[model samples]
Target chain A: MNRLLAATLLSLVSSPVLACDAVQLGTIEVEQAWSRASIGTSRPGVVYLTIRNAGTEDDALVSIDTPISGMPMLHETVVTDGIASMPHAMEVPVPADATVALEPGGYHGMLMDLTQVLKEGESFPVTLTFRNAGEVTVPVSVQGVGATDAGCSENNG
Target chain B: MRLTRLQKALWVAAGLAIVAFGVLVTIMNRAPEPAAQASFRPTFSLPDAEGRLRTAAEFEGKHLLVFFGFTNCPDVCPTTLSEVGQVMDDLGDEAEEVQPLFISIDPERDRELGLAEYTNAFHPAILGLAGDQAQTRAAADSFHIYYEREDTADASGEYSMSHSPALYLVGPEGDWLRQFTYGTPASDIVSDLQSRL
Candidate 1:
């Protein structure tokens, strides 16, 4: 019993650190935080991630903050009549026991006026605030310039 | 038992009618229904990524894949470009026969250098073309492509573009062959191109 308790405690403490892409705040779990690499001095780099809510209550992503960008805003790309339009979102909802994917051609967080170019194999930090879960910061890995799929299989947190 | 003369005549007539129906079906199957293609005037002379004036006549001997989007578009544009790159990759040496042309709708933001950067990120062989408002409008209008800037509410003054997400496939002589809708898998595109080749 004592050994089992120790193992559980160790897992609970080291889980977040072991999984660089996973962050937990209250019942909100953010995973596979990643962004695409950019060209020379390219501003307006977009960030993608998966937000999962495990709690019994609903939560909404209120805002996002990152020092690398001048303004981090929640945005979604809507394609209607074969025309794509991306508008600044007021908030993205994360309902209970549901998962929302911020992927290419869909919802993504825009880092407006990037201070530095995003390079491949590099990672940055981003803080996401939720209505109920408060806030959680996670490191976002920069994939290749044309990468679209999240490399979640490599690092499943 | 032998049939009577009247019964024999009826049976023969029925057999002939069945054979006629079979022939009609075969004829219908042999002639494939023509695909409805949107006709576009194959004409344009725009500056390529290297700032060299390129015309549709230059690519007369190869299949041209023309895509319209902006550099600021992070979603559909990149996704479609990546799919195009994958198609080229799967084509192997035959990719030389195909020219992927990316035409920017938002010429103000996507300058020559920016167009080069965006296209190079996908495939080196892809040509990124940008032009002034008049040139862009002519190119888009010639192809019947629709694109407009959506005024966003962000204080950063950043806006997104709404453009048709179809990839136009032109023949060697600048004839409209077919078009692929958005999110078409690379394998399907490769097969279509291969069949056409």
Candidate 2:
């Protein structure tokens, strides 16, 4: 009976790792890392997520890396006088104890020269580098092209 | 001097007639003015997602919602197209009369297949279009669209483009109808389109 109970308890403990979409490390909580599925033959794919710094010290997102693309660059879409422009961002700021959303129409990461299409329902690992919090590897869930509201949380459910 | 009964009735009838005429004139003056006619819509024969040459003449009896953007556009294009998709949803059956096309300003990056993938991903009805630089420029000049290509640090000759985000609504007869500014709600677009239809 004790052996059976131990097995059941072990299964319960391992389930959280499979269900959790959030990765909390040190003072940073990264949630909802997601990307839209690439359209036919589109080489570049975009990724978005929310980074929250729960600690008092501010952090800067130094860089990002993923196996799906050799060069993942930070970019933001700027609109002036009804003109839309996407400019390269050298670094992104994560204010202390505040949440910063890297979402559509704002800050985003471009996966340049994707070797393969980012299909829907597929999840890939992306490593994010922070000046203060170090590096954390998060899974980015791929969603449909029209998906803006759907995220890793929904897919986790 | 007191008038006779017949004369009094005749006088009252004349007064009533004059009051009716005054009311009629007031209503005529108060009625709203007619809507101003739109300028001529610029026509183009661009390659669609399938690499097929599609012309403005093909959609002669259907209204078109044309927008200019590129596939690499991560933010505004998707947002606007998604909103346009919502407008299509709100339209229901009337959407059959309305067709949406996404014209690529960056033809170098947005090829026929890529354009097809990007546009139809938002809404099935949204068709993607692309053409060479000269064709794009001519189309832009005709539509009065302003766009600029900014060089990027990447070595692959890949660059970013900046262009207007307005949604152009073209009439069934290939005439310019209206332009919806960016961030306009889907309900407003649907209502405007419904009223026009």
Candidate 2 residue pairs that clash: none
Docking category of candidate 2: acceptable
Score residue B136 of candidate 2 by CA lDDT: 83
Predicted candidate 2 versus true structure: per-residue lDDT over A61-133, tens digit per residue: 8799988887788998777876778889888999998999888788899888787777777666788999989
RMSD of 1: 8.7
Off by over 4 Å in 1: A1-21, A154-157, B1-36
Q: For residues B52-137, write the lDDT of model 1, one tens digit per residue.
A: 98889999989999999988776778788988999899999899999999998988789833778789899988898888889889
lDDT of 1 by residue, A63-136 (tens): 99987888788888887876667877889999999999888878899887788888776677789999888988
- Here, model 2's chain A TM-score works out at 0.82
- Global CA lDDT computed for model 2: 0.80
lDDT of 2 at B99: 91
